[model samples]
Each structure stands twice: as C-alpha cells, then as structure tokens.
Target: MLKKPTSAYVHIPFCTQICYYCDFSKVFIKNQPVDDYLEALIREIKAYEIRDLRTLYIGGGTPTAITARQLDYLLSHLTEQINLDMLEEFTIEANPGDLTEDKIAVLKDSAVNRVSLGVQTFNDRHLKQIGRSHNEAQIYSTIDSLKTAGFHNISIDLIYALPRQTMADVEENVKKALALDIPHLSLYSLILEHHTVFMNKMRRGKLNLPTEDLEAEMFEYIIQQMEANGFEHYEISNFTKPGFESRHNLMYWDNDEYFGCGAGASGYINGMRYRNRGPIQHYLKAIRETNHARLSEEVLTKNEQMEEEFFLGLRKKSGVSVKRFEQKFGLSFDDQYGQVVKELRAEGLLSEDKDFIRMTKKGLFLGDTVAEKFILG
Candidate 1:
C-alpha cells in the first residue's frame, strides 16, 4: 500500500464574478445550493478520515465569495478533527474586494496562516478588460488591511503580456508589486483557454495579445527584476524570499501525493489519480449517496511515473536529483536518460553536476521542450 499523504487541497467553486480568462469549474454565487454543497463537501471530507496534514490549501472560484458564517463553519469543521498543532501551513485563495473584515476575522481565528490574493494586475483599465471586479485601489487597500491584520505571509498573482499590454506596463506592475513589500509573487503570461471569452475573441481576431518574442522578453525582465530585488527564482513561475516559499505548492512541484476534496478537485493517492465531479449538484449528489464524489481514476504505470518526476521536478531551479531518481524507481538514471541529457547539455539547455541535473539559462526558457525529451515512451 502507498503511504498516506501529508498534504490536502480543497476547492470552493463559487465566484462572485467570472474572469474572461478563467476556465476553472465554478459558478456565479447566486441562487446555488451553497449551504447544501458546503455540508456535503464536509461530509465527503469526513469520510476520508484525515487525522493530520502538514499543508492544506483552499483554492477556488473564490473561497471568500461565501459569507462570513459559512467561512467560519467550513474552516471550523475542516480542522476540528485534524491535529492543528501538526498542520504547518493552511492557505486560502481570495480576491482583493472579497476579503471583508468579518471574513478576515474568521481566517485569523482559524489555523490558516497564508493568503493568496488574485490581484491579476495593478492596471485598472486592464482589470475591466479581463472582467475582474476588483480595481487597483482595492488591491492596495486589501493588502494594507491584510498587513494590518498581521498576515505577513501573503502572495499575489500577476499576469503579464496581456491584451494590449506593453513592456512599460509590466515594468510598472513589477515596481508596484515590489512596493507592496510582500514576500511572494507569481508572474504568468496570459494564456487563452478553450471555452473562455479570450479564446473566442482570438478566433475572431478581436484579441490583441503580445507576440511570442515579446512575451519571452517580459519573462526575462521579470526574472531580472525579482532577482535584483532579492527574491529567489525558486520555480519557473514563482519568486520568493529566503524562508517564504509556498510549502503547499512545493508539494506539487515535488511530485508528492495529496488529498483533493470538493467539487472539481483532483487527488492522487495509493498510486491512483482521481477527479471529483465538477458540477455542484453532481458533486453534492455523489457525496449524498456514496459519501465520495470521485468521477474517474487512473493507475499510472512505472514509465508514466518516471516521466512525471522529470516533467514536474524540472520546474524547480534545483531540478532533479540523479540519486533520488534511482532510489525511487530502482533504475539507473544515467543509463535510462543519459543520452537525452547529453543532447540537451550539448544544446546549452541543461547542466549536470555530481548531485542534480538542472536547467541552464537557455533551458529554463524552453522548459517544456526540454522536459518532453525525457518521456520514456
């Protein structure tokens, strides 16, 4: 049997307003059976019999979109049984305007120690273009409130190379983000997903996104600015101060298993990966009838598992360990992937030392292309 995972993730699929770029399973929080959903979600979690967790993340549509009482109820029952003393980090995702004072109090009293705000940009006009309800002012006010409330371990998400966005705009965003004095920042290039407004616009030639070369330039600029400001480029998309790396997210990059709960959530356990029902009613009905909401699962083969280790591990600046790969898979790393690594290093895309095989500066730019070469298939 596989060892029990020490991490857990819960999803809350209700947003007050939807973004043009978001395709996550979520609904507008109006007239949905939210109370019933919450009760059913808690019931499903209880069925897992989770006793202790080192990290727990409540991500969303918007966890803060719910009422203060519901937030308290969810937080309370979620941790009431788990050993709070052993829970290292509990994070919840919030929007800038959604974190009301009452909800803040609820979070402060709970075991939650970190908050990730969806402050997509500091540009107010772009905020509207992206269908975000919160403006630039609310972003500052919300951070000020969070800091005043003694929640220093805060992080924000920023999207660059947006529609009609310029290099100067990104610079301003970086400058403003640094001014906030927060410890972590996630910068991503805007991606148009299927079934989203941006995709449709792109089909009709209505969307004006940055060119591929410009996007790459913006990424390089972001890396330089973050490093110059004392933030470590710990992961491809994440920057952090010395001790403020996101432990919950690191669990994912480390390719460790974790329990996923709530609607549209996916979990991996005992060598099987499962996804819960996406629609709220389906998820609720599954929990009501079977005490679980899993819809489908897959058992990965050894080759697939090894591929995943390289695919996910290479995202970190520290890259993959040769010894760890051998120990985990009972196979020779150099014998299995030595030729591939040799070719990548010849292309100036990888660097290997005695311990770890890390991406070179060029390799980090073409990360996906480099990792695809390691697929055993």
Candidate 2:
C-alpha cells in the first residue's frame, strides 16, 4: 500500500519584476512559454493522481502576474478533480497591484480562500529601493478590493532590518501592517543571500544595513506589538489571529510529507525528498517525456530524519511533541537528546513540560543556532 500526502504546493515561477533580496527560483514573465509551462505543470500533477487534499498552495515568483485567463485556466484544472469538501485551504500568492478586478473575479469564482500579498514595507521609498513593483497606496487599495470581493483570509509578508532602516521606520511599518486588519502576518528580517542584489552591494561596501543590536530591537518590538494587538506568535516568523494559522505551512513545520509540483518545486513522499527541474525548458521537456520533472531525489536516513524533526519542529512556539517524536521514530526522546536538552535548559535556552520541549524567548532570538545544537552528527 502507498500513502499519499494530503497537502500539495504548486509553484509559478514568473514575476513581473525582480526584487533585490529575493533568490527564489523565478524569472521575468515576459516572452516566456506561460501556457506551455502551465500545461506541463498540470500534466505532472495529474501523473500524481491526486484526488483528495487537505490543502493546496500556489506560490510564486508571483502567481497573479499571469493573465486573468491563465489564472482561471490553472485554477479550474487544478481543482477540477480535487475533493473540495476535504480541502481545508486553497492559497494563492499575489502582488499588491496585480490583483485587478478581472483577476479578483477569477479568484472569487475559484476555490482559493486565502491571499498572501508581498507588501514587504509600507514606505514608498523603501518599496522602490527593494525593487518591488507596487507602492504603499497600491497595497491599501488591493486589500480593500480583496475584502470588498468577500475574501478576507489574508496574509502579508513584511521584511525588517532592511538596508539603512531605522527603529522608527520599523515602528511605522508595524503600525501600518496592523491597520490593514489582515488575519495573518509573516515578518522576516533581511538576510543577504548569495547571488542577490543586496549581497552584491554588501560585498562592495555599498549596502547600509542595521546593526545586530538594532535588528534585535526591531524583532522584540514586532513581537511585543503583534501580541498587544491580539495576534498569536504561533511560529517564529508567523502571527495569526486565533484560528487563522496557515495549515499548509503547519504541515511543513510538523514534518509531514507533501507533494511539490512544477519547476524548481520540492516534495517529500515515500520517505524520499525530491526537487524538479528548475529551468522552464528542461522541466517542460522532462514532463513531456515522462510526465514528471524530478531533477534530484534523496532517501533520508533515520538519523537524518530525526535531525530534521528537531530542526523544523523547533521553529514553532509549541515546539516538538516528545510523545509524537517517540511514537514516530520508536526511540525515547530523552534517551537520545536528554543531555543536550538539559544543557540548554541550564543555559536558559530551552524549557520543557511533560509532553513538549520549547525554545524560550532568549533561545528564539538566536533561532537556528539553538536548533543546530540538536544535530546528532
């Protein structure tokens, strides 16, 4: 018997404009074979034979950058065979100005119930500095339009500690974000990734980023303000109002398997993790020949799996479930990492109840450094 993952992620790799700090698998939308790519993506999904799903997410360079007709075609065929009653969430990522009236109509007619906007910052100058196509006014108008169209399950992404950013600037960004009244928010600090414009500028001594202490202060302010305004700091970078947490994202943090379709997408299933061909032409050719576009796959060892369990699970505020870990891996959590846990607890980095182990506020500030301590190898 084969077990199928209940959650799936579909990637759309086209964007109207590229940002300075983004390194995701994306290319300009102009002159690309958009229809051919969509057809190939559908072919790959159909090969999976997915019939029921708990969640379906369409992420992108920008999913809404395509034409309304293309969006409609993709959504319709994607959901045609899905068990809608069993699907808990259908999310699509969009830019601020991309969701025009025609596209909004397409979304309203589809099964998509959630929209994640890339509103990085509310300052128009910063928006331009970051290479974002939309301005502050467009964000407000887009949200207003989405709400008026009766779609309120919204989330926005904000980046802090940006180049030349000040504490006062972060405070104003947080204030504007809260005023939008969206149910979910993902706030991330600027990380200079390899091959990004920001990284290049940093290498040339042209990028003026905040100091570590200032960045920490910005983080603390965001957590405090979001909590004060009634949002749960459920995950390190995610906040939600009550039950609006992203179920698809939760699946990842919980270390559950899911399908990933389209170019540059990754998936975990049958104890194997795999990524598809990233180049559009390569992906289309592979899918056309074999109905799948897997470029690489790795079968995780038990030790590797356990390491990932701790690494991903520790990102959540609730942390890892000791009982669930024991049940899944058939090993006593204490026997394996009890010494490590004790050392971290002694240092005021970790705390434990009977059932779960969680990171303290001090520990969360260090983020990956604390999780790295649990790596067995």
Tell me the TM-score of each prediction against the true structure: 0.99, 0.99
- Candidate 1 per-residue lDDT, tens place, 226-252, comes to 999999999999999999999999988
In model 2, what lDDT does residue 203 have? 96
Question: What lDDT does the true structure give each of the candidates?
Answer: 0.93, 0.95
Which pairs of residues collide in model 2?
Answer: none
Error of 2 at 11 (Å): 0.2
Please give the distance, in angstroms, between residue 363's alpha carbon in candidate 1 and its true position after superposition. Answer: 0.8
Clashing pairs in model 1, backbone N/Cα/C closer than 3 A? none
**Per-residue accuracy of model 2 over 1-377 as CA lDDT, tens digit each:** 97899999999999999999999999999999999999998989999998799999999989999999999999999998689999999999999999999999999999999999999999999999989989999999999999999999999999999999999999999999999999999999998999999999999999999999999999999999999999999999999999999999999999999999999999999989999999999999999999999999999999888889888999999999999999999999889999999999999999999899999999999999999998888
Q: What are the C-alpha RMSDs, in order, of all predicted structures? A: 0.8, 0.7
